[model samples]
Target: MSHDIDFAQSAIRTIKSERDAIDKLIPRIDGTFTQACQIMLNCKGRVVVVGMGKSGHIGNKIAATLASTGTPAFFVHPGEASHGDMGMITADDVVLALSNSGNTAELVMLIPLLKRLGTPLISMTGNENSALAQAADVNLDTYVEKEACPLDLAPTSSTTVSLVLGDALAIALLEAKGFTPEDFAFSHPGGSLGRKLLLKVTDIMHTGQQLPIVSLSTPLKEALIVISQKGLGMTAIADSQSQLLGVFTDGDLRRVLDQELNLHTTPISQVMTTQCKTVNADMLAAEALNIMEDHKITNLVVVNQQNKIEGVIHLHDIIKAGVV
Candidate 1:
């Protein structure tokens, strides 16, 4: 076979091997997984994750997932833990240790100190009988049939399985705690996903004098001028009390033009849409986007619980907020 063909075949075999490894890991989630989740869930302090080498990389990601999903977690390098990083651990913290061989010297050596501090240890190892697993309060078996590596030396399938296992644990705890999207947003405020879940119409809507608003008795010509000045493409028609009466838009102008209505003389109330869709100021920005798309409209009148005009939210506002 040519060199390129050999390389392609090797890549395919590696994928197939890892796929089978994950398939094997499916049946490994049992009471032990529950026990591990329970320990971390009931932990008063934090879940401190530690691993050596390749396992350490996976542990870092696992720690992030756990922390984002409502479980407080942080990763500490096992090799560094012995060199004074163990001070980061405490009596109230639970330790999650990952080691494929289960006899990794750095992690195993700290079992006694963790015990002395009365900190619970959860171990993920390929071997159930290994010293680390035996020393742990809960053991999560991450055993795999074989390595995807051709030499069976380099870490490959094992690391992938460990990551998948970590995800399972994080999600399980998230559901157990009734974690909500708003709760998740608190952990990821800088991300677009967080903005979508956390942002409200009140956060991005055009309010106060910036709102394109006109009285019901105002001429259509003047309402169009308000829309042009505010640049929101729509204007709210309200009463003296600021109670929402209706909405007039560029689309309303189009239809009025088609009907040969004179903008200079027509009352805006006669041309405005009385049944316009509206959203509460407190509504999630994402929900407002859904409302706009569902009604095939671009702007919504934001109101308070009293149905008084609060502000207006445009499709552009939601999109700019990264909610769309």
Candidate 2:
């Protein structure tokens, strides 16, 4: 009981401290934040993020968020920049330097070279009057009242503020550029997000010989044979022009059996559902999943603008493609 009480007290204190820091930070989001966002939005090239120690870790994440959200960006170590990495900076690019004290020696040494290249600089610093802030084209104040560390040395609140400010700048630029989910997915094509946004119905749907389809005039037994042979649990009923007319599934077969209909003599069109849900060939797989989930169905017919069946999509296809 004593140990639990101690853990709870410690957790509470940390939360309160971070909360206080964040509350203090709210008032600092003013014209300076807007100016920083503008610089990045107007940049013709990438945003180069540079920092040291804990700030460097935050800078790396900031760069990643910016790149994925439509702003081209990369993280460059300040120490490496002084040796030879400085060549990465170009006149067309914008440099976002992060430093809590605003006096990191390595970062400061690159200022002259950065200016010589005519690259615009935005400084995220706790000290507004430090060398970095003074030399920056735009200074974003990320000052924190104190670190959450009991000793006030381990960078907690300061790093949080810097990271949150970086996120603010990235999101602001994203809005200004009118970036969409499709654009974001392009940048993250290897992840699940990319699969969700970039995967199309055509990419995963069963087409050509794999599509289970039968003419509307096909006998119910023949349609059941096609459905069994294709193993889709459903078959599309099309007209002479190959236009989709309806769908006959296992559910329909069961209902027809209950009615004592003669499967051998009945036409598939007589038992097929005329009002089935269909998707376009070019629609996103995510949208297709939504339709299946909303309609509480497992299978869908992929059609063209003329309502001709092009292919078929199932819940299994979406699962295989990692859209779910």
Candidate 3:
């Protein structure tokens, strides 16, 4: 089949036009946007995001973004609200309604009830004079010059503007609330981000007898045995008091071989790296990864406040745990 170059060119032109529209829309995020943010931030309860059709889809994403970014929010379809879902809204909550036309009948029907409940309403709309916008406590203008669609009928550019506006609102609230990576991690406990931000050395490190360890006076052969059995490629060398003294790795074995030292007879401590990097068990796994990258090393010993070896973490363990 022959490719339609015209279709591709038309699509590219549409995208460029939409991008230009969005660029112009950025300047409109001024006092009114700030006011909307203030209202939502000071709201005593959750944000109820409501819309219809394509706007509803965008509203759902907006609600999720807001919820994950430290704002309490949930999407409530306007059609559902006309039924029993309106009960989900309360006097303490704030409603964020999305509509390009700003006159969606299902949403307009809830304005009176929302006002009766004393809930604040924020509207994202292209039409400022429309009922939804005029009735709202704050109006966020999401007007676009035209839809990316050649016919100017499809939601394209308008929906993109609305989504970007929603992201702006979420990020503003996130910054206002001082929401940190640790807080975001708590809200996203099931993903790789959660592991990186929330999981600490203690959560994944091998402890007790599982830790490959050898006394500083142990023979190189004995240390190699510990490393082999544990399959960690390294052994923590500790003093008689069990304080971490150094680390012996496969790299050290290579150096030992180069020096013609007999692994069977030499003391492991003689070839170990004394200034090995160590981390606290309470440190985030992401932070640990940074240390590893910065030091150009793979294995790290989890140490206590007293600098005694508590556990060990290999780069492989971090990868397995989805921390990096």
What tens-digit string does per-residue lDDT give for candidate 1 at 165-239? 999999999999999988999899879889988898999999888999899889988888999999999999988
TM-score for each model: 0.89, 0.89, 0.87
Candidate 2 residues 88-174, lDDT tens each?
A: 889999999999999999989989998899999999999999999999999988888788888999999899888888888888888
Give the distance in Å from residue 303's predicted Cα in candidate 2 to where it truly belongs.
2.0
Task: Report the Cα lDDT for candidate 1.
Answer: 0.92
Candidate 3 residue-wise lDDT, 70-133, digit = tens? 9999999999898899999999999999999999999899999999999999999999999999
lDDT of each: 0.92, 0.92, 0.92
**Residue 49 C-alpha lDDT in model 3:** 97
Question: Best candidate, TM-score-wise?
Answer: 1
lDDT of model 2, residue 57: 100
Ranking, TM-score, top scorer first: 1, 2, 3
Which residue pairs of candidate 1 clash? none
Clashes of 1: 0
* Candidate 3 TM-score versus the reference: 0.87
